[model samples]
Target: MLLGIFIAASSAGWAIAQGAALRVPDVPYEPTPHNVVAQMLRLAQVREGDVVYDLGCGDGRIVIAAVRERGTRGVCVDIDPQRIRESRANAAAAAVAERIRFLEQDLFTTEIREATVVMLFLWPEVNLKLRPKLWRELRPGTRVVSYVHDMGDWKPQRTMTVQGRYGPRPLYLWTIGSAPDR
Candidate 1:
């Protein structure tokens, strides 16, 4: 009976493993340039005194821009220690170090409960994994802005296509209300 139970447990564990969702590997990090930053800011509608959070914040460009240009406070999160160091340097260089906090953490584990605006540049799978977290934490009117990717099964409140130095860039904006009709 014990041997049979062990076999059944092993089979069940294997089945659960097969049913688990897998996160795609991290994408190559790229900074949003100044022109793209402008469009994101426009779409996010960030105002002074608002707190912004940037998940997978690569090089701290978005956080730096938010604090420096919009007079808002920001939290910048990145899993890579090297990227965190780079973001610190970038924030200091931009003279917004006092207003932005750089955190070295996995994006899936970081908390943005106090944020009034959230920025994202992650892949679709990462976004999907984070959707429920955002819905649970963000206040009803808080804004979410994404670059290059959209949350599957959620419709954006606003969409903009801006012509940047590299080419046209797509920006998506959503609020933390009901999930958009799939």
Candidate 2:
């Protein structure tokens, strides 16, 4: 029974991703757990000097938190215009509007070369879709943090289950050039 439950839970994210794969839209706007948000920032080792990018940013919570907690500057990119507007408002509410750029742009087309740390709460397929982009665009040593999905075939440098809003959830971290890009 335990194994069955485990298998079901593990496959659910992928099933959802496949359902949404045709569009590859932003991972459903379920906000990352607040605890997980800080954990993601910490895992990425965010610093004031780091230029971060939160792809598929929803409500801009992650970027706002990064600026508020890490004193870092970042850009929030979400394909949804509504999310972009909400992010801007959230940034203002958090008093970090000037430190962040809100772009209502497709994640795939956005330029992420300037980022030293990138955060995501996207799906497995989206991560796979973005993996090559991350390798081709991000500079060596750039850190990438994904809340749940693992970039398929590119094993993460680190993976751990951390406390979240409901329970423990896996957070994956990979540093660009940690190994020669295959």
Looking at candidate 1, what is the lDDT of residue 40?
88
Candidate 1 TM-score to native: 0.81
Superposed model 2: Cα runs more than 4 Å off: 1-26
TM-scores for the candidates: 0.81, 0.83
Clashes by residue pair, model 1: none
Candidate 2: worst 10 consecutive residues by lDDT? 17-26
Whole-model lDDT, model 2: 0.86
Candidate 1 ranges with C-alpha deviation above 4 Å: 1-25, 164-166, 178-182
The candidate maximizing TM-score is 2
lDDT for 114 in candidate 1 is 90
**Per-residue lDDT of model 2, residues 7-70, tens digit only:** 9887887666644232446577878878788888888889888888999998999989989988
